[model samples]
Target: MGRYFRRKLLIYGVTFVIAVSINFAVPRLMPGDPVARMLSRNKVANPESSEAMRAYFDNVFGFDVPLWQQYLNYWAALFKGDLGVSVYAFPASVSSVIAGALPYTLALLLPAILLSWIVGNSLGAMAARNKWLDNGVLPVGYVFTAVPYMWLAILLAWVAGVILGWFPVAGGYSFALTPTFSWVFIVDLVHHWFLPFLSLFIVALGGWAIGMRNLVIYELESDYANYLQALGAPRRLVRRYAFRNAMLPQITGLAVALGMVVGGALVTEVVFAYPGLGSLLLSAINNQDFFLLQGILLFIVIGVLVFNFLADVVYVLVDPRTRLGLEGGQS
Candidate 1:
């Protein structure tokens, strides 16, 4: 197990280096100069003033330096936890901007992902055992999974927010209410949060249900289940084993989903105008904010690698077959 983990860590380390390099490269490859965009947006006219501002902006953004030096400086700054200044929200540090937006994304993602997984898996497992449930869950699960995230978000916003007037159409909370710990504020937050959360939850719920249903059915038909039944083991006992075995893949899927939480649902965020990393990223891109874009991408890369590592650790802990395979490979 120790050797196995060491190897995994080495792989992850190499992957991180490569991913970070790609993250750094991607934003620079994009067209348009961020500094120029900022100047244009601010309307910094006049030859002397424009030149002075352009030079200042270039120096501050490290565009005056060679590409190789900039890359090296990026790594150095990254090591010291400096994500640099944002181009879109000028004068604000990239880290601070991301920090402000992180909570909203987490609030939306965590509950949606976890609850959908739990409820979907339960429904799928139940459906696997009952013919009537299988008929209903199968079609509903397919439909839900097939719907696009953005379209569902729009539909929900139109029906629930605009037409029905049940919830506010956009924003994280009501503009009138200042962010505070009061009951009124909390209630308003939840009110705006519900539609976005529902869109994510309902979409995720379908895929898990379908996947688990199929896995459970396959597990129940596997040789071990047949043999257990042949020995006159209780049907419940056999199903308990099947469900446990079927959960291994679902655990992996859960890890991957959790890993992607940092990226969030870009289209959904855009549609709802929710203040999250996804919307922030879109702003970064539109304004050619390389620092912010790379910073967000870096977070995404680190998140995926970290969560995937956790998943590997979990697989070793829960699945004896994984351990045996490792041992066999070592031999």
Candidate 2:
């Protein structure tokens, strides 16, 4: 077990290194000068003196800093947890910018994700039990999954917020309500959170429903299920037997999905103007906030890595055959 864990750790370390390196390279390799974009809003160039303006442009866009030096500086700052200052959102550290916006996304998304899994899984179990339910739900689930989330958000916003006037159209809250920690603030916050949460649920629930449905359907066809049927097992026992076993495979996907909560949905956030990590990322990129972009990417990479590893560990726990296979492969 120790050796297995050590091997997993080593692999994760290597993957993390590669992911960070790639993250740095992508922004650096882009055509336009990121530094210039970063400074464009802040630096006002006077056209009166072409020479002075030219010099300013050169200083911002034509710097000949060695790639190695820039890479070294980036790594050093990352280690120190200083992702540099953003030129776009003046004087705000990339870390601070992300920290400020993360909670709103989490508050809305975390609940939606949890509910999707629970409700979807239950619905799937029901569908698996009743063929009529499976026939009814699967097509609807697939149709929703096929539709783009941004479009769904738009539709929902129009129907629920515009025509019905049940939800807020945009932003995290009503402008009238100050964000105090009082009951009034809390009530307003929940009221505001409803639309984003609804958007997230509409987008996420379809996939969960389909995935759980497929897993349950496949489990129902297994030999164990047949044997249980022959033995006249109670309905609950049959369901428990099939679901418990089939859930092992589905667990890995669910774990990885949960891990991606930090990444946020860029299109959905943009459509709703939701103050989440996804919106932060879009703003950072538009303004060429390199440090902020890199920080968010690193956070995402680390999250995916940790979650994937946890999934593997869960795989081992759920299916002893997996550990046996790993042992045999190692030998």
Candidate 3:
């Protein structure tokens, strides 16, 4: 077990280093100069002033240094939790910019992924046994899963939010409400949050249901299930055992789904004009804010790695094969 953990830890450590290297290289590889991008967004008229301004910006952003030194400085700042200043939201630290956007994304994504998994799995497990449900759910699930998330979000926004006038189509909250702890502000926040959340929920639901349905059916036909039935176990008991074993893979699927959920939520946020990491990422890209982009991507990498680690732990607890492999030192 200790060796298993050590191997996992070493692999994760290597992954982290590679992720950081890629994060740093990505912005530098982007076309156009960050300094020029920043300058273009300003109104400096004089060529001499512009030149001087550009030189100063270059030095401040460490573009004046050799590439090796700049890379070294980047690592130094990273260790100190300094992600540098944002070129887009100038003078703001990358941490603060990301901080402001992170919560909205967490709120939008976490629930959407979890709820969809729970509901989808339940429906799928049911469909596997019930022919009537299979006929109804399979087709609808296919259709729902087939729709692109952004288009579904737009359709929801137009139908429920625009035409029906039941909800706000955009933003995290109403413009008039100051972000207070009062009931009115909280209600307003939920009103705006629902459409995007629902869009994500509906889209993710179909795939889980379909996968769970197929897995459950397969597990029911497996040798263990046949043995249970041959031993004269009740139908309910056999079905319960089959569903429990089938869910092992479904749990792994949920972990994989989480990695996609973050990006999906961000895209949905952009569609809804919600002030979240997705919108922040767009701002970082448009202005070539390398530090900010690096910070955001780093956050995502960390989140995915952490969730994967947790999934490994959960798998070990639930799946006997995983623990046996660990004991055998299967690396």
Candidate 4:
């Protein structure tokens, strides 16, 4: 087991390095100069002042350095836990910018993914048993899964926010209120959160439900199920066994879904002007904020790799076949 984990760790480490290198390379390869954009936005009129500003920006943004040297410096800074200051949000560290947006993204995504998976799996498992439920819920599940996430978000915003005026159409909270721990602030936060959360939850639920239903049905019809039935095992016991076994794939799916939470729900944020990483990411791109973009991508990469590693460990623990293979290899 130790050997297997060491091997996995080594692989993950290599993948992380490669992913980081790619993330660093992409922004540099893109067209347009970030320094130029910053100056343009600032609009320095006098040529001497413009020249002074240009040189200052060049020094601040490391445009004065050679490409190879900049790349090396990037790695060194990263090792020292420096993500650099945001070019667009000048004077603000990349870490701080990302930190500010992290909460909204998490608040929007975590509940959506978790609740959807739990509800979907339960409903799907039940659907396999009751034909009436299977007939009724399956179509609804299909519609939810098939709908585009952004499209659903827009529809919900229009119907609920625009027409019914049930919720705020945009922003993480009411702009009129200051952020605080008071009940008023909390209520406003949930009011704005509902549409985005619902869009994600409703969309994700169908996929989980459909996948679980099929897996449960298959497990019930598998040879082991028949053998247990022939031996007169109680229906509940047989079903309990099948359900436990059927959960393996869902466990894996859950991990991937969780891993994606950091990068997930981009469209929903865009639609609602939610104060999250997705909105921040758009701003970063528009202004060619390389450091900020790199930081966001790095965050996403680490999240995915960490969760994937955990999933592998969990799968080996729960699935006897995987454990047996590793054990046999040691022999």
List, in order, the clash count of every candidate structure: 0, 0, 0, 0
By TM-score rank, best first, the candidates go 1, 4, 3, 2
Tell me which of candidates 2 and 3 scores higher on TM-score. Answer: 3
Q: Sorted by lDDT, highest first, which candidate order results? A: 1, 4, 3, 2
Per-model TM-score on C-alpha atoms: 0.97, 0.87, 0.95, 0.95
CA lDDT scores, all candidates in order: 0.93, 0.76, 0.88, 0.92
TM-score of 3: 0.95
Which residue pairs in model 1 clash with each other? none
The pairs that clash in candidate 2 are none
Q: Pick the candidate with the highest lDDT.
A: 1
Task: Give the alpha carbon lDDT tens digit for every residue of 1-331 in model 2.
Answer: 5578889999999998898989888766656655456445446565555446545544443244677877777788778987766655756777888888878877977798878777777777778778899898788778867888778888988999899998887888778888889998888788777877877776677777788778877887888888988999887888887777767766776766666865546777787787888888888777766667787788788778887888878878877778888788788
Residue 40 shift from truth in candidate 2, angstroms? 3.8
In candidate 3, stretches whose alpha carbon ends up further than 4 angstroms from where it belongs are none
lDDT of 3 by residue, 80-175 (tens): 989998888888888899999888888888898999999999999999999999999899999989999889988999999889999998899999
Winning candidate number (TM-score):
1
Model 4 quality (TM-score):
0.95
lDDT of 1 by residue, 179-251 (tens): 9999999999999999999999999999999999999999999999999999999999999999989998999
